[model samples]
Target: MTDAQLGLLVATPIIIVFAVALRRMGAVRTTGAVVAVAASVAIAAVLFFTQ
Candidate 1:
């Protein structure tokens, strides 16, 4: 895979963990955290394939 793809793959779990913890900490609303994570993953995926 390309560097961007690898970067994204690695970032996925980190983002998920951050999302969960942030939600628990009340730093991010439940729905918002999930949505944010989803959007981040999508952006990463797009960047991966495009690069």
Candidate 2:
């Protein structure tokens, strides 16, 4: 598989895990939650596209 595909495969579950853990850790605030997820996705995007 391509790097992008691999990134998606890896990042999806990672983001999900992070979201769930962060939520449980009391980071359930709207802004913080979004920012946390967004940052992870952004990092994933960068890795996905950078190759």
Candidate 3:
């Protein structure tokens, strides 16, 4: 797959895992999930587009 697609694939699962971990660690469930996903997507976007 292309870099962008690969970046997204890698990022999404990572984000989900982090979100779940954050929830389990007693963070606010919704906030944790949002932050994890947003952070992952932002990083992925940078990596995907910059290369």
Highest TM-score scorer:
1
Off by over 4 Å in 2: 2-8, 24-27
RMSD of each: 1.3, 2.8, 3.2
Q: Name the best candidate (by lDDT).
A: 1
Order the candidate numbers by TM-score, best to worst. Answer: 1, 2, 3
Residues 1-51, candidate 1, lDDT per residue (tens digit)? 777688788988899899999999999898999898889888887887788
List the candidate 1 regions with Cα displacement exceeding 4 Å: none
- Candidate 3 residue-wise lDDT, 1-51, digit = tens: 687778677767877787888888887677768877788878777777776
Clashes of each: 0, 0, 0
* Candidate 3 colliding pairs: none
Displacement of the residue 8 alpha carbon in candidate 1, Å: 1.2
Q: What TM-score, computed on C-alpha atoms, does each candidate reach?
A: 0.77, 0.56, 0.55
**Model 1 CA lDDT for position 22:** 96
In the range 1-23, model 2's lDDT, one tens digit per residue, is: 69676868687678868777888
Worst 10 residues of 3 by lDDT: 42-51
Which regions of candidate 3 deviate over 4 angstroms?
30-51
Question: What's model 2's TM-score?
Answer: 0.56
